[model samples]
Target: MSTPPRPGMESLSLILLRRPPNPPDLSDDEADKIQQAHLDFLDDLRAAGVLGAAGPFRDHDDPTLRGLCVYRTTLDEARHHATTDPAVQAGILIADPITWWFREGEIHLA
Candidate 1:
C-alpha cells in the first residue's frame, strides 16, 4: 500500500535528447563539425567529473529519442551542460534533463 524510503540515494540528472522541431538542414561537413564539438563537450564534462554516462541510442522505438546523458549533478547543472552542447546550440538535438535518484555507486558504466 505504501512505499518505504530507501537510503543512500544519489541525485543525478538524466538528460533525454530529442529531435528539434524544424531542425536545421546541414551539409555533411557541418554536421560532422557539430558532432565533433558535441563529443568535445562530453569529454570536457568527463574530465571535470560531472558526466556519469552519455551516448546515442540505436534501433529504438522512439524516433524522437536521439540520445541521453547521465550526469552526477543536479538538474540545473545538467541543463546548463546540455543547453551549451554544440549539437543542442546548432539545433541538431534537444536536451531535456530530469532528476533521477538511485542507490549510490550501484550503477556503473564502462
Candidate 2:
C-alpha cells in the first residue's frame, strides 16, 4: 500500500542565509569567531526542530557561504525567527529571504 497526500494546504518556507559571491575579507580571528557563532546558532535551531539541515557551499577557490535552513512554518514566521538568529545579528551573513515550497508525502494529523 501507498500513503495518500494531505488535503488542504501545507506550511510555507523561507531560506535565510549569506553567500558571498567572492572570498570573504575577514581576518582569521574574525572568521573563527563568526564560524563559532554560526555553529552555535545551528545548534539552537536544531534543538528547536526548525532546522532540517544546513551547511556551506564552496565554489571554485572562493569560499562562498551557501547554506540552507528549513523552517516548519509560514514564510513570515520563518523570516521573523531567522532575523533573530545570532548569525544574522553578528553581521556574518547578509541574510536573504526566499519563499519556497514542497509537497508532503504523508502528513499525520492529530
Candidate 3:
C-alpha cells in the first residue's frame, strides 16, 4: 500500500507549456528576444528555489507536447509566473497549470 502524504508537505505545480493555436507572426529577431526573456524568467525562478525543472521537447512541430515546468509553488503563483512569460503574453505560447504530487527527494535532474 502507498503511504499517505504527511501534513504540511508542500505541493508542487506542473506548468504544461504549449504553443498557441494562432501564434503571432513574429520576425526571427522578435522570436529570439521572446525566447530569451522566457529563459530569463525560468532562471529567476530557479534562483529563487521555486523551479524544480524545466525543458522543451525535441520535436518543435508537436502541438501537444511543447515543454513543461515543474515548480514548488501554489497553483495561482504558477499561473502568474506562466503568464509572465513574454511568449505567453505575446500569444505565442500558453501555460496550463496542474497540481502535482511526488515523493520527496525522488525527482532529480542533472
Candidate 4:
C-alpha cells in the first residue's frame, strides 16, 4: 500500500545535467575551477530557495548523463537558473529540462 499525493501541493521543475558531445578541452586546474564555480552557483540557488535538490549521477546508462537539478520553480525558471551555471556556460556540463510531475512537498533538501 502507498499513500497518494495530497491536493494543493506545488509542482517542481527538473533539469538533467549532461556532458556535451564535444566538451571543451581544459586543463585539470581549469576544470576544477569550473566545478568549484558550479558548486558555488548551486549553493547560491539553495540559499535563495530556488534549488530543491541537485546532485551528480555516479552510475547511469549513458556516461554523459552527469547529474540532475530539481528546482522549486516553473520549467522556464528552472531552465534560466540551470543555463546560468558556470559549468553549463563553460560547456563543461549541459542542462536539459525534463518534464517531471510531483508535488513540491514530496521533496526537500537540507
Candidate 4: where are CA atoms >4 Å away? 1-10, 103-110
lDDT (C-alpha, whole model) for all candidates: 0.85, 0.64, 0.81, 0.85
- lDDT by residue for model 3 over 1-110, one digit each (tens)? 12337743435688998887788899999999999998998999899898889999885667666899987777888888898887789888889998866666666644
Angstrom error at residue 46, model 3:
0.8
Worst ten-residue run, lDDT, model 2?
A: 1-10
RMSD of each: 3.8, 6.5, 4.3, 4.8
Better of 2 and 3 by lDDT: 3
How badly does each model clash, as a count of residue pairs?
Answer: 0, 0, 0, 0
Which ranking of candidates, highest lDDT first?
A: 1, 4, 3, 2
Identify the candidate with maximal TM-score: 1
Model 1: pairs clashing at backbone N, Cα or C within 3 Å: none
lDDT by residue for model 2 over 1-110, one digit each (tens)? 11224444344465647654544578888878878877887788778777666667656464444576666666666777777766566666766766553355443322
lDDT of 4 by residue, 1-110 (tens): 11326655555678999999999999999999999999999999999999888998985589899999988787888989888999999998889996564675665556
Location of the lowest summed lDDT over 10 successive residues in candidate 4:
1-10
Model 1, C-alpha of 105: deviation from truth (Å):
4.4
Candidate 4: the clashing residue pairs are none
